[model samples]
Target chain A: MGFWKTWFSTPESVSATKSAAFEEHTASTGDPSANSDRIVFSTERDIDLYELEELCDAVGWSRRPLRKVKKAIEHSFLVASMWQVRGNQRRLIGFARATSDHAFNATIWDVVVHPDFQGKGLGKALMKYVLKKLRSEEISNVTLFADPHVVDFYRTMGFMSDPEGIKGMFWYPH
Target chain B: MGFWKTWFSTPESVSATKSAAFEEHTASTGDPSANSDRIVFSTERDIDLYELEELCDAVGWSRRPLRKVKKAIEHSFLVASMWQVRGNQRRLIGFARATSDHAFNATIWDVVVHPDFQGKGLGKALMKYVLKKLRSEEISNVTLFADPHVVDFYRTMGFMSDPEGIKGMFWYPH
Candidate 1:
């Protein structure tokens, strides 16, 4: 199918080169932490779901079934996470994923940072990484569902609620 | 990867059975129309991008690049469309797609109906078809981005805007 041609022709090599460049940039412009406590970010989809669920739990979010979580990750267009690496004991600290049309629009979902990792700029770093990656893939128009309390946090990162007055709506089976 | 096991193990057979049943149901309880003008809905992914683009244009939506549109369709979890059949001629009248986590959450996108087909309950039927398909897969939460004018329309079908005070946010590159 021509669709497969378009899908396979996505600029993966360009994204890989950009990701390497961003890693270098991130390393040079480091966040404050000791060498042993460095935070590393990755776009790898093979994440440890148990660690992700624990991170969610640490942030007071409800538990998602690991089976469903794995399904979500499998179907996602992009999954990014941040980890605190302390002498090979890596801990999932921040997590986010986006489902996209892989073209005109994408919506960010399940963004959470462990409570202990909050206020250390990890959330901002994680979001920046996610947005930059989307940009690398040439996807425009990123959207997200946010809790009311954290609206300002996203605002600082250039996110606006309901741009052009396009409202978000939901349906739940009764 | 265990992830592939989960992805491959999705209940395709169950969904297929439900889709066949739904097709039977629709054929029996369809909207008022002569047999010649019957509207049929399908979950098939191999839609003609040009026809879809024409339908979007007929609804006054800005033209999306067909290449990106194809990429979007390839990545979408589900793509559903409604068509008006007249003997040998099938005209695309309505379209919608969703990107899902395949378990917990799904966001409906690019919902549109040709202007000629509006006000005859085709939009409602199209949405019902999409929601039924999602429910068959056991997706719990469904969300969509709506223009302010259509908010009431979705509300009439059990969609609430920002339920429980959750907000929607967007980010665009400067």
Candidate 2:
């Protein structure tokens, strides 16, 4: 069992996954009582940085520069943005960013919906879109650090408090 | 003020970073008696899948396909693999993976050193390399889920126990 022997072999490139099962759940957007056909969701397509900054600011997140936010969106493995398009204009209503290896693990970050759109179910739809995207890739084991108030919201999406023995730790560089 | 007006501006790419300060800490390798110049630490060149699998197996992590491991190595925002090379042969002994937005936050995963290399201070050297890399990128906030026993190891590097009111949570899809 010489482990060193395999070190010199040529490495393979990562493969691309199929488009997620977005079509089946397109109707899951919007209130069932309202017209389901009205809302549109896009993933990593035609995103606007100013709207993203607004989405963060509207939720009281720190104001990061536009470039940082764009890099965050571009580097994420899955990004969900729910929009309300009228004529030629699009409004970013809900957004989330996730990073993963496209294999074993993923962690979701910055899940937020514009305050005005909170009760309209856009947040739930955006999360489901994220899950659908990960499921399409067969990547499970997702984690996220959440504020206490949103624990219930995340719980509804199948996230749970970490088990008894596990603890999350942080370090902030000076 | 119209918030959406900044949407059309072109954002700058995240900037490049200087090399992490790797001092004459080379003697931290195997034994002080052996010359320290033989070990080379690489951010992303010459990773061996078999040795990575062996490292994971030695520590009881779940077995993953070779390609998945290679992809994980390739996609990380920063990766450090400490290797010992003599002539044309190299052995990977320590490894760490971290993902970040290159701005605000980074979480480290799979910080492992070969069992044979455990007590030789390789882990500390590897973690310091990780911190140095993150510092250069200006990603100030970092987190990692650590085993209770290793909490002290991380604290030495400036990771405090997460403060009160913050809890890490997880979701595993069936």
Candidate 3:
């Protein structure tokens, strides 16, 4: 079988490999503390849509249809979420996803951090973790569409606007 | 099964449905003439990578690894190509692919037409066919990253640069 057929034939193994790698990384860095306010990060896709929707709503992003949001999560190349853990309770605080060609290019989308979690460096850390994961998979070009106000935030993370004179264009059918 | 599972479970059927729809549309408009020059568009993914690479090279795009290209095509939601048909000979003259969430949004990539095939209306036809397919499936937001020189070309097709003040950003890890 070709690489494509082989890769798709066993998506579970692929996800397992990613999850294991992420868990190993977290283990080395120190797992989530049981009694602290530190936020724990996860690459698991089995996230709750209600919590995700609430996170988006908390940031003032217009309500996206939960059905469509679920579909997006199902098809994404990767999804990263951050949680504020206290004892056994966990609260979803950040979310982001990427759609990639799985080799040469990947574009990040729908990056959102709960309003309560903003300005605390958690957003930056979320981005860093996401980028690190993409880089580990050997994807070379990473791109994203950002709002005008947050352009500087991305700039601080080594992202340049319209690099090499490539501009993003959109079409909304009437 | 949920929509995502059902969708991915039968990708072949999805491609077949698209191919059948495209063929029906073409047949209704007018079939390609055997004695005259006419371009035929297809949504098939079983294309020869060498021909596609040649088409990309003809447009002066940098070389992309064929292995990676194959993987990209396998993962894409849609891949459209145009051919210059003359009897049994069909030459690949245009190509484009889209990666989507299967809802909400999609991004087009690797849109290229052979240099020799430019100036004709083939590129516009290719884009129209792609947009129609996406719309048929109810995707609302369509986007693409374009070279600065072709910004006006896309603008004429109702694509605005950075719509609603959403700027494109890139990160290239060193």
Candidate 4:
């Protein structure tokens, strides 16, 4: 691995080891909370509209019509939520939603970690939960758009800038 | 409107005019062909995998594993295909796909026009069809990643950069 990185070479062929490594990594780390916070992650898509709105407002995302907001949450293929459960009450703290064809490609969107739980790895945990779900469904090619400040954080989790010529674009009618 | 652009706005309340203008725009030009090319756009989610594969390959996007490619196409919420029909045969010349929660957000992906059909405005027409679908569904936040070179093309269609502090990120495990 050391020699391969320093020297120039063609991008290597798909290695048999990568699939095994990914499976092992996911299997070992699958459902465990990384630290003592006990932040539970849920893949249920039944999040309440008011709760979602509060999360977005807390993060300063633009306020949108409630119906539109609800559509975005319910239609996602993988909707992961991070929670802090005390006895019977579950407080929503982090969220990450993905839209994918459940096969070739998926894009992660609107990832938020409640301000109160920002320092913990809840966001990462939410993403990992989604990734594991996608993996089980055999989907690949996950993508997302983050604010530049958090780009480095996503990079730490295996995302990279567009390869060569590809770029990201969007239009907001507001 | 001009003053609103210059100052630090708390992101004012959603305006009524924007929605009216959007409705007018779509109502006026919604289904018409842009020019003499006679391109027809369809919002049908069913697509021919071989044709899609050929389009992706033409654009030199890394060839996705075949099953993943098939799944990506099947799962899109809105798949806008541009066709040039000649006497009962429909040719798939341009393609774009999106996945949205049909409410607050949608992301466009794998936009490609066959190299033979590149100069025409089919790409824009396909996008317009998609925007209309999203608009009718009441989805508001729409995003896509493009190469920096064509950012202007997307801009002309009303997409701006990462609003001030935002950035786009992705991960390709291949």
Every model's TM-score on chain B: 0.81, 0.77, 0.80, 0.73
Error of 2 at A4 (Å): 51
Model 3 residue A70 distance off true place after TM-score fit, in angstroms = 0.8
TM-score of 3: 0.81
Could you tell me the lDDT of residue A47 within candidate 4? 75
Candidate 3's DockQ: 0.62
Q: Chain A of candidate 4 scores what in TM-score?
A: 0.75
Q: For candidate 4, write residues A1-174 as lDDT tens digits.
A: 222231113232113222333343344445455322234555666677788889888989887777666666677888777666455466788888888877767788878988876754556666767777677676657878777888888888887766564566666655
Model 4 misplacement above 4 A: A1-37, A60-63, B1-37, B57-67
TM-score each candidate: 0.82, 0.77, 0.81, 0.71
| CA deviation > 4 Å runs, candidate 1 | A1-35, B1-35
What ranges in model 2 sit over 4 Å off?
A1-37, A85-89, B1-32, B35-39, B85-89
Residue B59: error of model 3 in Å? 1.3
lDDT of 2 at B24: 27
Question: Which residue pairs of candidate 2 clash?
Answer: none
Summed backbone clashes in each candidate are: 0, 0, 0, 13
Tens digits of lDDT, candidate 1, B3-55: 22332355664355345434643565564545345566666677878889888
Instruction: For model 2, state the Cα shift of residue B81 in Å.
Output: 0.7
Docking class of 2: acceptable
